[model samples]
Target: MSTTTAPASATVADAGYGSARRRDPVLIGLWISLVLVAVVWIAPFVFIVFTSLKTTGDVMTTGAFTPPATVHYQNYENAWARGDFSTTFTNSVIITFIKVPLGLFISAMAAYALARMRIIWGKLILLIILFGTMIPFQVMLAPIFTVVNSFGLIDTYPGIILPYLAFGVPYQVFILHGFFSVIPRELSEAARIDGASDITIFRRIFLPASIPVLAALLILDFVNTWNEFAMALVILQDAGMWTLPLGLMSFQGQFSNDYGQLNAAIVMTVLPATIVYLIFQRYFVSGLMSGAVKG
Candidate 1:
């Protein structure tokens, strides 16, 4: 009797070939979708960057999407000088740094209380907190302005930050509460059994575990604070105290005829937030799942 068998290498190769062929359609579809999405997402940024390099005449004659015949580097210089970006940018940085961490700390503590501690009317308090997220920004504008004016805080950093904190805290509390809810109660109990205080457990365990979510929130809050125009406009009447957004609005009138310089200002306005996002992008994906819970 005789038997024939395929060689080991041949068998392995055939299996791999078959698997790849079976997956070919899915892989091709995935690649196509990614390419399409990338092009769509990048299109506006490309348009802005290209438009920013064209003179006003180039912009008008060459059409919106057309590349400039001659690159204009002076647009950036003109934008920075005319927009007063240096001072406005510094103002934004100070405000964002002050508010984001303060908001996060307050939110995290509020979340810990709601998720971990037993208190009278805790659920009622949480409902009120969650309800704050639903209120429209416009609706709060008058009240906030009134409160700030009554306290004589207008044109000051505190005037801007206090209202921002009030508007921003509810959302942070909502998210942080959801995340803290998923953290098993047993972990806190175990720490308590070992004589760890509530603050100790929070600082040593919860905060360390929550770094990814906190980092994600840090970037979001930073962007929001940086780009915030309405509140800044309402609170900061003094030109010297204006943030980037307010500066941009006022500067837009100066560059009305110069689209290149206008777009250059836009780029500079968006650049810091973009840089912050790129720096913290790794944590963003994992932190997105922070509020999910067990079935």
Candidate 2:
């Protein structure tokens, strides 16, 4: 009996070892796939940086992969000076700054009321907002243009900003509604028992807890507004009022295109938001997961 038990124990130990050995190749394959994905994702940005540093002659002569014989930092300098990006950058910043906070606050308030406060037609209101998400921007463009033109908002910052806010609010509201719904009712009830007003509860308790969702929403809204081109193109006729996307369009001439300068400008345009995402990536991920899981 003892000899039979010893062989059985040895076989079990060997089986466990074999299982671990099999998992090793799976882990290795997963890691290799991840590395490949990372390289593919990063390669374009790397090429852009290298191309931006190359001279027009070098860019036209050698492929972007070839290391520059001498780095020409002048491409960036020329692009910055010649491209009128200063105004473009400022316009984007202003639009983003105004839109994000306003959108978040309004959306949060609407979401809170919709989710927490039992009101008539609450479900209908939510349905309407959700339905609006399905409507394509292109469909509304003509009507939006006529309205903006009537208000004399065309060629003005408000023209661009108001539309962005209007369209962005519904999506923000939808996301925040899901988040607000998941907040423990007990917490809000406790606040009320302590004589806190709804506004006070929202500001003190809900807002603080909802920071991650807010951060994620803010990042999404900012990126969307920053990269918006078609609306800006149609609405904004003034060159000085152009955003980065519109400004980049000028790089493509009727007869010729400045690929080097265009690449440089593109790099500059993307850098700020890229840096922002890198910095807040942790919060963004956490916020998204929290909202998704809790909702």
Candidate 3:
């Protein structure tokens, strides 16, 4: 049978109409808003990178927002050497590695007990722990200092790591509790039936299932411990024990600050944290979404 198709002009008109009809104003507005927010969020980092690349003279003459005539890559090397970052970076790494694993392990155990086992005043205990997280660390700084001094741990790694564990545990417990509570009770019961101890079950079953949430917790706690300044400043008096944040402060001086070197240090300081977040971001998002759902 012979067939007749619509004219080219008619087909073109229909395609245009369909395209226009599918365009939603709300979605367009949302995209525009996101772009704007991204620009605002990213502007400071861009400015910092540009400033890091410029010579001190260019920065004073042209301003921070302007692109550099030539990228001054040596600023990073200079900053690292001048700031004594090698020592600070090592201290930060040691503290983070020790504290993050220990803190996560402790918090996970507490969360599992509260979430899966029958215990007296478990809710009350959990509530108290949550309250600990809510209290500002600054309020306890003086007392913490006194206690650390009493133990003669001042200017030592233990002084900082101990406090990080104390402050970090409560929040980690809170987050892990939410994720753990939503896990199927039947899984644990089946493991129990098969002769698995609580620790064994936690190690084998729960830990595997909890990877996403654990990754999220790791990122959060790592960033917090790594970037923590006030506590490190107060607890660590020795130059040998200073963390990256404290070391960065050394770049600033009374008469003249090395803006170029300082900005380079800032970029280096942020790089590790940024890389960590990027690595775990997928798991972090999924963990957050799962935690938000009602158990």
State which candidate has the highest TM-score: 2
Top model by lDDT, which number? 1
RMSD of each: 3.0, 2.8, 3.9
TM-score of each: 0.88, 0.91, 0.90
Clashes of each: 0, 0, 0
lDDT of 3 by residue, 1-295 (tens): 1233457667899999888878877779889999999999999999999988977888888866888999999889998888889999999999999999999999989999988888899999999999988989998999999999999999998999999888889988888888888888898899899999999989998888888888988898889988999999999999999999988887655213667888999998989989999999999988776655548
Off by over 4 Å in 3: 1-23, 254-256
TM-score ranking, high to low: 2, 3, 1
Q: How much lDDT does candidate 3 score?
A: 0.88
Query: In candidate 1, residue 11 scores what lDDT?
Result: 82
RMSD, candidate 3, Å: 3.9
Model 1 global lDDT (CA atoms, 0 to 1): 0.89
Which model is ahead, 1 or 2, in terms of lDDT? 1
- Alpha-carbon lDDT, every model: 0.89, 0.85, 0.88
Better of 1 and 3 by TM-score: 3
